[model samples]
Each structure stands twice: as structure tokens, then as C-alpha cells.
Target: MPVIKLTSNTTLHYQEMNRGAAETIVLIHGMMSNLSVFYFNIAPMLAQRYHVVLYDLKGHGLSSKCTWGYHLQGMAADLIQLLDALHLRQVHVAGYSYGALIALQTAVSYPERIQQLVAIEAPDPFEQQTLARIDAYSKSALLEQIAAAGKAQGKPMSKRQLERNYNLYHFLLKQTTLQQDMLAEKDFMQQPGIDRLLHNTLLLYGTDSPCASTGKQLLRKIPNAQLAWLAGDHHIPVQQPFQVGSSINSFLQPRENRIHHFQPSATSIGVETPGWNLAM
Candidate 1:
């Protein structure tokens, strides 16, 4: 029930659990999901080692809805302001699906405010063939399946037909959004004033997931990025949280020392202190 007010009169509902060092870890959920999805998965494992922040994005959860567009920039800005209100200067970020796209934007848009970023299965520029496959997903039949599942909400996707229907719907939504979002992407990714702010980023993908290649590609683009693969599908963090958690913890343990490069500013509270000097 906790909520924070942003500058544009948008109210975002969030949950916070304090742990670890002063550093904060923020979790952003995907399209059609609330922060609760991560609650059963990533949050608990991370809470033991990092101050955790999970919040609802506009329109998706208890957060305020925009009268206009649900653009990624707006979402990223909302996160930035949320940090300001919480008195957190910088944070380590992890996001999935649409949230992953937003996380990527956050790193680019406000590079200085992000210390470590992990984008799990977000999309990238695709080939023409990829677009063709995406287009097929937007058919009316798929959208109807999605709408039905959205309405049903936990009535048990116990049947194969039911699960297939839900997956179809998810595909439709992503396809619809990709078409509109891609147009703005070129300009957004190449803003002149934006710096190639570098961070030690982690890119994750599921071996059986469609997004795996994009994860690998992202690692190539980001100089400091590292890549990892889990065994399941797109929802690996959900289906195999423990496995994902183990990988994340192991990766971070060795790199803990590098997190202290930046000084805390008004926009970066709960950031890693420069001189903790821990031997992990």
C-alpha cells in the first residue's frame, strides 16, 4: 500500500525492504505485471544482500495512469523521480520484459544515476524476418486470447489449451507495442548529449527463450556487460528463481569492489560508498 508521488502528479505504489549495505537495488516489473511477481522470486534472495525497492509502473499496477502515452522515457523519468523522493542517489537496477527496456533507457538517459544494470531478455533492433514473426502475433485471435487470460487472472492455467491461450495473448501485446515503440527508438538511442555512460552490466537470457540472442547482442554492445543463460523460458526468473538467484549472487560477489566508483549526490542516496573496502 506504500506509494510515492512523482513530479507529474503520478503516484507509484512501491514496497521497500532494507538490508545489505547502504546501496539500493530497484526492481521493475514487465508489461501487465505488478511488483508482486518478483516478490516470490528475485526480491527475497536479493533482500538479504541489498536494500530492495519494487514498485508499480503507471497503468500496470496500483500506480497512477497517464492520460497520454505510456512511453519508456516517461517510465524512466518516473523512476528517477522516485529515487529523488526516497533520497536515494544511485541504485543497481534489474528489470524484466518491458521493465528491461525501461532499465536500458534508464542507464542511457541517466547514466550517472545507475551504478550496475542487469537487463533480462529485453528486445533490440531486429531483422526484417523478426518483424514478420512479430506481426503475426498481432492478429485479432491472439489479442482475444490475451484479453481473456487477463480477465481470468489465476483461475489456473492448468490445461495446455489455457496456457497456450495466455502465451498467445502475451505475444500479441509485445508485438503491438514493438511496432509503435520501434519508430521512436532510433532518435531515442542516439540523442546527441547522451554520454556512453559505462557500468558493469549483466545480460541474462533463458536458453530456450526467444530473447536469448538479444541478451547476447546486448552484451556485445555494452563494453562492461557479461552474459548468462538459465535453463527455462522467458520467465526463468519466475520458474527458476533459486537458480537465477544463485547465478546472480555468484557473479556479484566477485565484482563487489568495483561498485564504489561514484560519489553520492542528492539524486543518489543508498549508493555504494567509495571506501568500504570489503574482501569478497
Candidate 2:
């Protein structure tokens, strides 16, 4: 229920844990999802080592709804506004899916305000499937897609969950500019300067995710990045929260030479160098 009024005249709901830490990590959720994605599992884990911040993005979760500013630039700007309002000059940040794109954009736009970077299951915006989904977005289509995905995993969603999801999906798809903003960002990954992100970066992707190729692309783009694969596909966080949370904790561990390796064969690129550590 805690919220902050952003400079944009919107109120963003956020939660903070492990106050008074020397450093902070901001968690951003993907399109249509909210801070709860991390509140239960990931935030608590990171709070053990660093102050953690999780907030609902504009028009999602408990955040005040808006019809504008869905582009990556606007999204990154919202993040900066949140940071400034909280008086945080810099933070470590992690985001999933489209949220990851916003994190990458933030790093590119506000390098001094960032420390380490973590990207989980960030899809390449240019993927045809990604565009198709945006162009074909509909509440019913989303329900069907979610149902199909749920069925594939042999887990049927309850009626209450479906209703909740539908309300959010309907607003984002049929009632806002989000889809257009998303389609406009199809070339985001191809933009210059993204290849030059200087933060010690962690790229976490699902071993079986179609977006693994994008993770590989990011690994190649960021000079000081390491890639680790988790067990699930796009839903890695929900499917393997403990593994995901622990991996993030180990990466953010302050002590030098402290590293943890994921299950064998799940990692693609991991190396140790002077003054930096890699999550294997």
C-alpha cells in the first residue's frame, strides 16, 4: 500500500526491505506484470545483501494508470524519477523480459546511476514473435495464450487468477499506448552504445527459452558480462524462484572471490577476472 508520487503526476506503489544497506538494487517487472513477481522470492534474497526496491511500473499493479510513456525512454525516465524521488543517486538494477530492455536502456542513458546490471529472460525486441504478439494483442488472445501456456505446463490457472490477469491485460492492451510503444522498440537492441555498457553485468536466461539467443547477443554486446541459464523458459523466475534468487544473491555478494555456480551445463559464458566476479 506504500506509494510515491512521481514527478509525472503518477503514484507508483513500491516496497523496500533491508533498509540502511550501503547499496541498493531496484527490481523492475515486465509488461503486464508487477513488483509482486519479485516481492515474494527475489527481493527477500537480495535484501539479505543489499537494499532492495520493487515498484509497480506505470499502469500496472497498484501504480496509477496512464495512457502515455510506454516507450523504453519513458519507462527508463520513470525509473530515474523513482530513484531521484527516493534520493538514490545510483543503484544495481535487474529486470525481466521487457523490463530488462528498460534496464539496459537505463544503463545506456544513465551510466553513472548504475552499478552492476542483471538481465533475466530479456527478449530481443526485433523477434517476429514478439512483434506479432504486440500487433495481435487482445484480451481474449492473451487469455488464450496464458491458458495454453498453463496447460502446457499441466497447471491450470484458477478463475480468480484468470480474472485478475484479464483485467490488467485488457487495460494494457486495449486501453493504453503500451502496444504501440512496444512495437516502436523493436529496434532497441540494434541501437548503438548498448554494446558498450561498462557495468559488471549478469545475463540470466532460461536454458530452453527462445530468448536465449538474445541473451547470447547481449553477452556479446556488453563487454563485461557473463551468461547463466536457469531451468525454465520465459517463466524462469516463477518456475525456479529459489535458483533465480540465489543466483542473484551470489552475483551481488560484496565479498570478492565469492562465487556460486549454477547446475552443470546451465552456464554458457563464465569467467573470473581481476576485480570482478562471474555467476556460473
Candidate 3:
């Protein structure tokens, strides 16, 4: 329920934990979802050793709603501004789904302000199936999707939860420019700087996820990156939160210790964090 107004006058609701820790991490939830995705399991586990901030993206969850600024460029800027307003210098960032793309964009645009990157199930926007859900938005479909997502997490959506989620969905699909802006991100993965990003990065994807291909693409695109497959599909994080949280924790450990844990696949090459300093 915590809220912050960025310099742009856009307000965002966020959750924070372990504020007194030495290091800070920000978790961003994907489209149509809020901070609660990480709030339940991921944030708590990461907070034991690091300060954690999980915030709903603009136009989602209790955040300010705007018809514009749904593009990655704007979303990334909003994230940086959120950090600035919170007085956080540089911090680790982890995002899921579309949120993952925003994290990459932020790191690409403001490399000096990022300590590490964690991208979970970041799909290629160019994929037709990726945007089909957006283009084919329907109120009933949204409700079914939310209900299924909740069911995947081992709890069916209650009537109130279903109504609340549907309202957010209707607003985003009907009142906001989310789909159009997302469509504009088709070239995101091919950006010239991708192959050049040297941050210590971790890529998590469901083994069976169609997005695994995009993860491989990122593994090849990012210099110091590695991909780890969990046993699930695109809903992997919610399907397997403990595994996801454990992987993130192990990856954030010291480089030497972390390196051995990530056994590489043939396509997942050159995984090392030589460009980042551990002292941070």
C-alpha cells in the first residue's frame, strides 16, 4: 500500500523490506500483475540478506494510471526516477515477463546505476504469439487468465480478487496504451548494445517455455550472462517460487562460488562477471 510520486508526478505503489541492509534490490512484476507476485515469496527470501523493493509498474496495481508512457523507454525512466526519489544509488534489479524487458532497458540506458540483472521469462516481443494476447484482449479471457494464473499458484481466485484483477485488466486494455507501446518494442532484443552489456546477469526461464528461445538469445546477447532452466512453463515463477528464489540467491553470491553452480548448456556461453566489482 506504500506509494511514491516520481518527478513526473506519476505515483507508484511499492513494498519494501530489510531497509537497513547494506545492499538493495528492486523487483518488478510483469504486465497485468502487481508487486504481489514477488511480495509473497521472492521478496521475502531476498530480504534476508538484502534490502528489497517490489513495486507495481505504472498503470498496474495501485499505481497511477496514464494512457501514455507504457513503452520500455518510459518505463525504464520511471524505474530510474523511482530509485532517485528513494535516494538509492545503484542496486540489483530483477523483473519478470514484460518487467524483465524493462529491467534490461534500464540497465542498458543507465549502466552506472545497476549492480546486477535478473530477467525471468522475458519473451521476444517480435514473436506473434507474444502480442496475440494483448491484441486479442477480452474481458472474459482476462478473467480466465487471472483465474488460471491463481490456480497455478495453488489457490483459485476469490470473487473479490477476480473482480479486482478484471478491473485492472479492463482499464489497461481499454483505457491505457499498453498494447501499442509493447508492440513498439519489437526491436528491443536486437538493440546494438545488447551484445555489449557486461553486467553480471542471470536469466531464468521455464524449461518448456516458448520463451526459452528468447532466454537463449539473451544468453548469447549479454556478455556476462547465464541461463538456468527450471521445470515448468512461462508460469514457472509462480509454479516454482522456491526454486526461483534459490537460484537468485545462489547467483548473487560471490562470483567464484556462483560460477560453479551454473553449469552451461552448449548455447549458453561466456558466463562470467568480470566487468562488475563485488565490493559494491
TM-score between candidate 3 and the true structure: 0.85
Which structure is stronger by TM-score: 1 or 2?
2
Residue-level lDDT tens digits of model 1 in 39-139: 87678788888898999986556786544345678778989988998888999888886688788888888888898887776755344433343334224
lDDT of 2 by residue, 80-142 (tens): 998998889999999987889889999999999999898888888787688554334334335
lDDT of 1: 0.65
Which stretches of candidate 2 lie above 4 Å from their native place?
Answer: 131-158, 259-280
Q: All models: lDDT? A: 0.65, 0.80, 0.80
Q: How many backbone clashes does candidate 3 have?
A: 0
Each candidate structure's count of clashing pairs: 5, 0, 0
What range of 10 consecutive residues in model 1 has the weakest lDDT sum?
264-273
Candidate 1, RMSD to the unseen true structure: 9.2
Better of 1 and 3 by lDDT: 3
* Model 3 lDDT, full chain set: 0.80
